[model samples]
Structure formats: structure tokens, C-alpha cells
Target: MKTSFSSEFAKRYGLYALVTGASEGIGRCFAEELAKAGVNVVLVARREDLLHTLATHLEGTYGVLCPVIGADLASPEQVEDVFQITDQIDVGLIVCNAGFGTAGNFLDGDIDTELNMLSLNCVAVTRMVHHFGLKFKHKGRGGVVLLSSIVATQGVARSAHYAATKAYIQSLGEGLQQEWHGSGVDLLIVAPGPVETGFAKRSNIQLGKSESPDVIARQSLKALGRQKVIRPGVLAKVLSLALSTAPRWLRIKIMSSIMGSMTKQLPQ
Candidate 1:
């Protein structure tokens, strides 16, 4: 991997980054990418074992400090604890990548789980962006990456709540991009399609054509300061464009059908 973008990115922003959901998948990729760029990382997630393991790996691989903070992002208190942990660190970048999905007819699934997803995906993201965003503005330099999904462009079946939460993220990130225009704080909304992660297993559904976590992470870093929104992978770009042009009703129907197929594969 080339150090040109990574090194330059950390230098322009701060040398320290805070990555939520940093134990696995895309979040892990983000932490690794930043560490490669000579940025120290503060990894936040719910699993202590995974967090400590990843922290150790990054520390040894990149020779950069990696602090592991185990916190369930859905809890308001835990979210605040994350901020407190980073309070003393000069965190220049924040990647809000901690979120999950529930797949089933919305009314049929466990409402409590959906609520938790909402809290983690939307509520937690808003708080982090608001708190850390201000710090970046006062300092006049920083970066924020909010992980959204192509499904956010329209409603999808089986995972309506999850999609809706990402929709909030999409709108929030877009608005913040303009709100912080002159604040020297760059915000990148990463709306990628399905990726090869444990999301399908957790959600109890199948997945479609997906990119690797590292692929999405790389595209995000490349688009960091240059673009406000990025749809990584050719397939993701295509899906985004198609959905944007299609009528809402038709788009929803198509997504519903896609969701139906994926859900059908799971054991009932």
C-alpha cells in the first residue's frame, strides 16, 4: 500500500483517529488504514476480546498506539464514555461505523432489537458527529466518515428499520457537509452497497454482490477530502444511480423483491 494518501490524510487532519465498530469488517479496515498512515487509533466496539486483539495487531503492525475501548454504542451512557475516553487524545478523525440490521417483516420481528439498531445507527451517530464535529471546527481541522448504505436511497423490505436509520445518516452527513463548509472539517458519507461481512448472519438474510471491507475503506480514504459523498465499487455506483432515477414506488418495489429473495434463503 502507498503511503501518499494515508500520510497526507493524517497530516492534514490530526495524527489521532477514533473508529467506532473497529473490531471487525469495515471499521477494522478503517483502523488499519489509518494506522498505516502513521495515525494512532482509538478503537471502540462492544466486544472486548476483538477490540484488544485488533489493538494489539495494529500496534505491532504499524508501530502506532491503539487504544481499545469496549462500549455498546446503543447505550447513551456508553456513547458518552467513548467521548470521555477520547477527550484527552487529539482525535483528528472519527469514523462512525457502528451499526446493525434486523431482517424480517418489521412488525413480526422483535421490536426491542430494532430499537437498539436505531439507537446505535442513528442516535449514536448524531451525537458523535455533533460533539466531535464541534471540536474539529474549533480546532479548524478534522475529518468525519459516516458509513451509510446504498439501501438508504430508498426503502427496502425485511430491513425497513435498518434502511431508515441509514437514510438518517445519509441526510445528516449531506447537511453537515454544507454546514461545516468553512469550518475546515471534512465530512465524507460513504454509501456502499452490500459488503462481505457477518451482517447477513446477524440479520438472518442472504447478501448480494459485495465488495471487500478493505475495498470500501480504501475508496473512503481516497475520497476523504475530495468529495462529500462516495458510492464505492462499480456495483454500488450503479445501484445508487439507478435508484436515484427510478420512481420511488418502483424503486421500493424492486428493493422489496430483492429483500424477499434474500430473506427466503434463511431458515424460517
Candidate 2:
């Protein structure tokens, strides 16, 4: 959002940044923000028509090239194909933000749905990072960001799978940062408490603690050069710290209660 960062990010990217899940929500914000910053973006999502429409709008308004890459991230072959497409682009940045969550117990939901969530949230992220990260490192310049959740800090009840998947992001990000030390590869993991992106509505979560997805995207971009866990608010930071140091039982109990209440909207 800052003029300096935008200029620099655009310069580094040289008209190429990949934003997954660009159909809507936080992913859409990432694409728009990147375009505003003067970086050409390749939007990836399952919806081809949405991507095409967005591409036209972005190109017409920002004068930045907006390419659409349609693929189901839950599929490894599709994920590989995306990498091949991006392999030649001067992609100095990547926002691997394509992910979804369910609002019910493990067994209460369809088994295939849970597996799809895992593949998209965890496996695709790791694989794409592996693909782009290696290339970025070889080029000696690039930044990668992973979208995580505040719930990752503790065990929550209804969001059993979602919480764990986000936890994996937190751990993976921290670990990769260490492994890539002095490698000129930047990795940032963002954990936001809640966003007003209507993910809650989609999951039937009624809580109003949601922040705007645009705000989250801005904060995430601002935290790019910094190496640390980025949270959007003081409450998010406090919760993360508390969950990290608090007694296991207490943390679990609190998260369980909150998530349990939230999941009341789901099937019984």
C-alpha cells in the first residue's frame, strides 16, 4: 500500500506475481493490490469465467497484464501444470492463498471433502513453494507468503481439520524460513483472527469478529520484508501468545467452546 513498497515490489516482480484463489475473498484482494502496485498478476482459481472477467477488468483499469490459470489445486496434476505455466514467467513473488474450510466434525462431513481441503490447503501450498521457492532461490530473489489462521495456535473443536491445517502452515513457514537462511528467499506466514470475507457465511459461522479481507491483504503485503509471524490485530497477537504458552487443557477448552458454539450452524 505504501508508495515505496509498491514501487519496489513491482520492480522486483517485473510484471509477474501469482495469486491463487483469485476468484474472490482475500485472494481477490491480493490480485488487486498487486496490480495497483504495478505488478502483472496471474490469477488462479477453479472458475475460468470469473478469472477471465477479472483479468479484463484489471487489465483495462490498471494497465497490468492479468493472466488466468484455471485449475483445481486439490489435484496434483493440475498443480503441476500451473507450475509449468509459471515456470517461464519472471515471478518474483507468490501468494499461495488458495484454500477452503469446513464447519463441522471430521466424520460428520464427507470424507472426500476433508481430503480435498487438505490437498488444497497443505499439499498444494508445499508443492508450489517447492517449485517456485527453488527457482526463486536459484535466481537469488523472491518472496513467498502463506495464509494461515489464528486458530492454528490452539486446538479448536468444530474446525478440527481446518485448525490443524493452519497449524501446519505456521510450522512449515517458520521451519522454511530457518532452512532458507541467507538464501535470499523471503517467506512470510500470516495469521488473522477473523475476516469479514463471508467465509463465515459460507461455513455458516455467525460470529462478527471478522475483519475485511482487503485489510488482511494489505497487512500481509506490508509484512513481506519482515521475518516474523504477522497477525492483523493486537487481539490476534495476544491470542497467539496465550495459546503458545498457556496450559494445554485451558487452551483446548477455550477453543473447543468457541468453535463448538460456532459450529451450531452446521448439521447435527
Candidate 3:
């Protein structure tokens, strides 16, 4: 299904958008959606081959410019490299969708992997936001899409650190939304539930009911300037509503149980 955006979206955000993690999954979907809107895209990811293939498809199909930047955001040096290239481009929109998650006990997880996750999910996001946030504000028009998860709302046992990272994004996006309210820089935090993406395989977790990446991407773009936070897709909305009134302690336990189920199949 093709996602369509209003002319106002392109007008407000301008010609170019940069999507981190655009090699695959939700990031790829975001890239497709933006390209469908006739916005030129700069695709950023570690896999240069995948990025090139995707760039070809997007450019061929959507007839929009797709510049591929291959860099691991987990590395500080690589992030700097990305900045050097993007600095030359007038990117009016940035989708900070490059992040991974870990499953199983926090203590059981590898220290290196957890640290890497912290760097990519929290640190990299902050850097991008700080750099582009200022640029957008100065220009008085831009858009920022932060991909958070429903797990961000509370602590989950098997996915503690992963959830914590998303919490950081959730808090940051919410704060920036209010801080940049009148600055003509729109900030949207998309807290989606389980999505049908490569995350399940890489994270070594089994999803229950999940939403399509397209649904998440389409809905998020549509809500970019209209709202501060959005729980896109039916699964996300249902989960949010079901847990909204629960006590914090209850939310934690419930989420823990759900996470446990998803990760239970992992080798113990």
C-alpha cells in the first residue's frame, strides 16, 4: 500500500529528509513514505549494499533523490562522518529510527551489546536532535520523527535496558515538543507496539500481535506536525488504552510478563 501525504507536509518540511536505519524495517518504510510524498531522501545505515539497493528502488519508483550514507550510528566516529556529509545538505526532516533492542535478563545480556545499544539509541539520537534541532529552529521550519516503542512507558523485565533507552527518547521528544512549540519545528514521538519488522529476529524475541511497518510509518508521518506523541496502529492504541489506567507497579508487572513471553523462546 502506498502512503500519501498532504502538500502541506512537503511545504512545511521542505525538499529533503534524512532517515537513519533506512536500510530496512521501519526506517525503510519511513523512507518509502517520505519519498512517496515527493521528498528527496538521504538514507543512512551501516549496510551500504542494502542502502544502495533501496536507493535504487526509491529513486526509480518515486522519482526522488536518495543519497545513501553507510555508517554505524553506534560508533561516535561514524556519527561524525554522517554529520560531515549531512551538513552540506538542507535536510528539513530527520527520522531518528536507527536503534536496536535486547531481550532476556538485563544481567544476562552482553555488556558490549548493551553499551552499544545505549550509544545508538540514546546518544546518537541526542546528537542528531541537538544538531538538527538547532538547524530546524534557526530555519523556523522542520520536522523530527522519533521512533519510540510502547515498552518505553514502563520497565520490562527481559527488555529492561532496551526499554530504558526508548524511555529516554520518549522523555526527550515530549520535552522538545513543548520547548519547540512555537518555533515552527515539529517534533513527533511515535510510540508503537510490536511491529512486523527485522527487530524480532535481531532482538531474538517472538512477537505476539504486531502492526505493519507501513501502518506505523504512514500514521506517524500523517501526525507529524499535528501532535506531540502518537501511539500508531491498532495494536499500539489497544495496548495503550488497556494499560492506561493501571498503576505503575501493575504496569511494570504486566509488561514484564508480556516481555517474558516474547523472549521465552530464546536460548536460556
Candidate 4:
């Protein structure tokens, strides 16, 4: 008999999953999906109220145990505390999905904000992967989902720092997937395009067409173990392919045009 993806995930990765940035967007969807598959989850985010609300909903709807942890991933002390808080919970799967973006000209953008973005998107992610990866390696079973973005393939003009950080994640995930192969652990990097989330508003960018977060989350889970890297939607896949196949000069010009439009939407 063939096993379902959700059940296979639960079985191979164990019964508990920890999701960062679990208060909203794709992170929240991941928690709900895992709960539906009978996996207890530890929800980590900066907004305690939102996390608790989500925990309550998941517990009530799916009958799964959901623990909430409020932590700012950008802060070293808080990121360290996340592991300490979850020390007792046997987290078999980790979705290091906590990250943010910024838009506008690199020179015009606040330097501090960009650095903080790097800390959360790169440094914090590195720490989380290293800490949990060792545990998964020792056990010889578990999985990790690292979030990247379609913009990772090139230098996006207005969102330079954000794109760079995602590029770092993409490379990291690719290398880790190879390193963990045949070791009974799995790593998947999901590079999604624009989604209907708070990201656009926060980044002050005008996003074009976008898909629902639910679609991205579901596709991401199914792609796990099956693919090393995935661009969630058809549009994103097409864009990724085009970027890869296009000449460097053409790609840069195209992305620059897109970024110019997005930047125009930013408040003066």
C-alpha cells in the first residue's frame, strides 16, 4: 500500500514539528497542515497574542497540542531562548520560516533595517539549522523546510538586501540537502514568488499578481523529500526557468524594470 505524503511526513519526521514565524502567513498555514496530519506543533513568533490565538485554533480544530513561544528571531538572546524553551519537546521537523523583507533603493533604505533583516534571515537561520540539524543527524531521521524567494536568483534592485538574504538561504539549503543525503534526514528549499501576505505592505512594494499562502504551504509540503528545490506556483516556476535561461544582461534589465515599478509605490 502506498503511504500519503502527510502520513509519511509524520512517520519519518516524528510527531512534533516546530515552526518559526508561526503567527501569520505561510508559517501559520504550515502549522495548520501539520496539525491536520496529527502532528503536534510548537509555534514560535514575536507576537504572543497572535501565536496564542493560532495555538488555540489549531488545538480546537485539529485536536493537536500546540505550544506557543514568543521570540524575536533577530535578537541573539531570544533566538537562544527558543531552543531552551523547546528543549523538552522532541521536535522532529523544523520549518525555519521566520524572515522579513525591505524594499526601495539600497542607498535610500535604512542601513540598520537591512542589517536586522540579515540577522534574522541569515544569521538566525544558520543558528537554527545548525542546532536542529545536529539533533536530526544524531537520530538519523527528520526533515527541515527552509523558505527562499523567487527573487533569490538575481539581484533585485529595490529589494537588494531581501533578495540577497533569500539567495543565501537558497544556497544553504542546496548544500545542506546534499550533505544530509543518505543520512536519513531531508532538507527542502522552497522558493515562492509573490504571495498575498503582509510582506508587500511592510516592504512598501507594489506586488503584481500573487497566490494564496495556503497554496504555497501545501505545495511546499508535497515537494518535500521529492525535490531539492521548488518554486511553489506555476508562475513562480516559469519565472525561475526564464531567469535561469535568460542572458545575464537581459535578466538584470527585466528585474530592474520590475523593481522600478515596485519602488514607485513606496511612500515619499
What is the lDDT for 139 in model 2? 81
Tens-digit lDDT track of model 1 for 1-268: 3367557866788778899999889999998988887788899998989989998888888788998899999999999998898899999999999888888888888889989999999999999998998899999999999999888878998779888999999999988888889888999999988889877788888887878999998899889989989999888888777788889989889888888888996434
Clashes found in each candidate (C-alpha, N, C closer than 3 A):
0, 1, 0, 0
Can you give the TM-score per candidate against the true fold? 0.95, 0.93, 0.96, 0.95
The residue pairs in collision within model 2 are 196-211
Candidate 1, overall lDDT? 0.88
3 against 4, candidate with superior TM-score:
3
Off by over 4 Å in 1: 266-268
Q: Please give the range of 10 consecutive residues that has the lowest summed lDDT in model 2.
A: 1-10
lDDT winner: 3
Tell me the whole-model lDDT of each prediction, alpha carbons only: 0.88, 0.84, 0.91, 0.87
Tens-place lDDT digits, model 3, residues 147-217: 89999999988999999999999999989988998999999999999999999989989998889999999
* Model 4 residue 219 distance off true place after TM-score fit, in angstroms: 0.5
Positional deviation of residue 226's Cα in model 4 after best superposition, in angstroms: 1.0
Query: Which consecutive 10 residues in model 1 have the weakest lDDT in total?
Result: 1-10
Order candidates by lDDT, high to low.
3, 1, 4, 2
In angstroms, the error of model 4 at 174 is 1.0
Report how far residue 192 has shifted in candidate 3, in Å.
0.7
Candidate 3, overall lDDT? 0.91
Error (Å) of candidate 1 at residue 92 is 0.7
Clashing pairs in 1: none
Cα error of candidate 1 at position 145, Å:
0.3
